[model samples]
Target: MDYNEDTATDAVLASFEETTDPRLRAFLRLLVPHLHDLVFEFRPTLAEWEYAIEFLTRIGQKCDDTRQEFVLLSDVLGVSMLTETINGQQEGTESTVLGPFHMVASPQRKNGESIDLLGGARPCVIDATVLSTDGKPLVDAEVDVWQCTEDGFYDVQQPGIQPPGNGRGLFRTGEGGRFWFRTVVPSHYPIPQDGPVGELLKATGRHPYRPAHVHFIAKAEGHRALTTHLFVAGSPYIDSDAVFAVRKSLLTDFTESRDEDLARQYGVTVPFVLATPRIVIEPEEGDGSG
Candidate 1:
């Protein structure tokens, strides 16, 4: 009974062949081979294996309604973004990780409304148009937007300080395929750092910060839904996203200004930044409802 790494992994994986669940059986069979290969490549000592197991256990222990440590772990490892990219339909804008903070359901708002539940000192307006790749407007498209505050804290992060829907809005496109929302310019911020993922980041000498960006899960009746981010151009981590979710096309401009007339038109005050982003969606051939 030779108990080498390959033999041990094989023996363990062999036990799952009878798993009634197809997903469980498939995952175990695939994962076991990869795990064996990784063990052979790394050749970790007994202590290293124990430490890895403890770290994984701690990640599971850190999950709750508000916090999801395993998602954080996947994010830092680039697994989340990688999985999204691999499975994403290549027709539309590039997809990125949704992150772990979008736990709250966003409240629906009209075509032109404000998601900044927190009254802000700096004014900002986000104007966006939804269009199909064939140069046609896609009306009634649902754009679910969520982001952290200017100070880099999501409403969920500071429940007592921020309202439940502080920086989240679900906007439906108008007949002309247009949507606009009022919000404050978001700032670059770090991912949650009070858990095992943070400890891993610290140990690896990597920063846990993500670039300033607005998340969107946009869907239309017949178009492939896209989960993406409009990353603020020139943000601190635009080049070095801790999660590697930044795409060049998704980089957006936030021009600062004091346009009084424009502010009046958008129902906001002067001295605000304007963010006009047009998301180009390439609906699947059979998936665009006129």
Candidate 2:
């Protein structure tokens, strides 16, 4: 068949007929039609297409060992959160985007250990409990935690200023499924915007700020792992997250406590912020709870 506008989608899809993977073949078939429709509906000249290709290339070029502009692209487009939501827990802590800054492995830490390598005004204690959907304590759960500092910059973002693993930690739930950490309350900050994604946001007049939150990934045997955030109550941009990852259930109160005894107990000083959040883990499929 001669390649023509009428037969373009069919021709392109047929070219993938020999694909060995059934799922991939099906996806290409679905993708081609939409692509063809886009082209037909709003036809672009060759120069326009070249600029589009270059735009995509720059998105890839912006990535590196510690930076991911493509993930940022998905985040700004709302695709990351949509995909996570599609595969997310239906009955427990709702999952959010694994923001690009989780670039490196968190340093392993013991319960009640501090993750704050830098000092800030709002010293905080994250006293958390991991439990099953049935309210049973989930012991030995691997809880990987990370967040920006009080200044709104991650360790990865500030190479020399912040030490490695400054605001990151890998902890395990211990007795009563408890895991605690000491850190400063994070500040709301803008997503990295010195790349092509930034250009797009500026052209669209959108701000790139996210609300103050601590990232957490909880994993326990025989249960589905959860990726979520503990959003500080009343944080700026809570209603307008740049990545659209916020959920009301994830809002946590960063209450202040002036009790010196509580401070000494958590190994911090008085007037520290306290956040107690319960993370309920959902069981894996066919784990008898499903």
Candidate 3:
């Protein structure tokens, strides 16, 4: 077979005939032709291809234990959210991208405890509940929560300033499948923009802002886990999340309240911000992951 434009794709596909793994062979079989067609259609110059290779190289080079530039690159390109959307559950809460910041394990804490290690002028309390699709409360459900600070910086983003496990907690749902926590109201802020992903965003004239929201991962026995967000109502970037993870059903209002009784019940001061969000998960079907 001649290695001309007419035969290049077939030649390359033939070379992978012994790939052993059927899935890999099938994947490459589909990928090679489309990639070759794209190259021929676009006709990128030598220098342009070199630049693209170099850009991907830098994205890999920028990754470390705490930072994930490749995930950020996928996220900015909408691939991450698209993947989550594909495997999304048919019932219960809609899944969203597990953003790069969820790289570490949350420290265990009691219900109604404050995740905010640092004190703030305004405190917000979140009362959360986990339930099955049939409306039964899931007691002892593992509810993991994490969020950025009031200024929109995560604990990992600020190592020296914020202590480890700041703004993160692992809680077990108590009676009525409820878990509560107090923290400072996080501000809507831009995603980290200091890597190859940032360069791509700038080149495309796209903003890197995400809406203010608290991340939640709910898990219980005999049910599929749910990964979603409690998006603050009327947040700055609610309609234009940089990562395209906003769901209207997930929008929760952080209502300001002055009820002394409720405040005393939750061990908080008067005139606090309160957000109540419920997470529902579908029961595990045949061969479903727990």
**Which regions of candidate 3 fall more than 4 Å away from where they truly are?**
287-290
The numbered model that scores best in TM-score is 2
The residue pairs in collision within model 3 are none
Computed on alpha carbons, the lDDT of every model, listed in order, comes to 0.87, 0.94, 0.91
Q: TM-scores across all candidates?
A: 0.92, 0.98, 0.95
Candidate scoring better on TM-score of 1 and 2: 2
Q: How many pairs of residues collide in model 3? A: 0
Best candidate, lDDT: 2
- Residue 108 of model 3, lDDT score: 100
Cα lDDT for residue 41, model 3?
98
- What TM-score would you give candidate 3 relative to the actual structure? 0.95
Residue 42 C-alpha lDDT in model 1: 96
If both were scored by TM-score, which would come out higher, candidate 2 or candidate 3? 2
Candidate 2 lDDT over 130-170, as tens digits, reads 99998999999999999999999999999999999999999
Model 2 bad stretches (over 4 Å): none
How far is 172's C-alpha from truth in model 2 (Å)?
A: 0.6
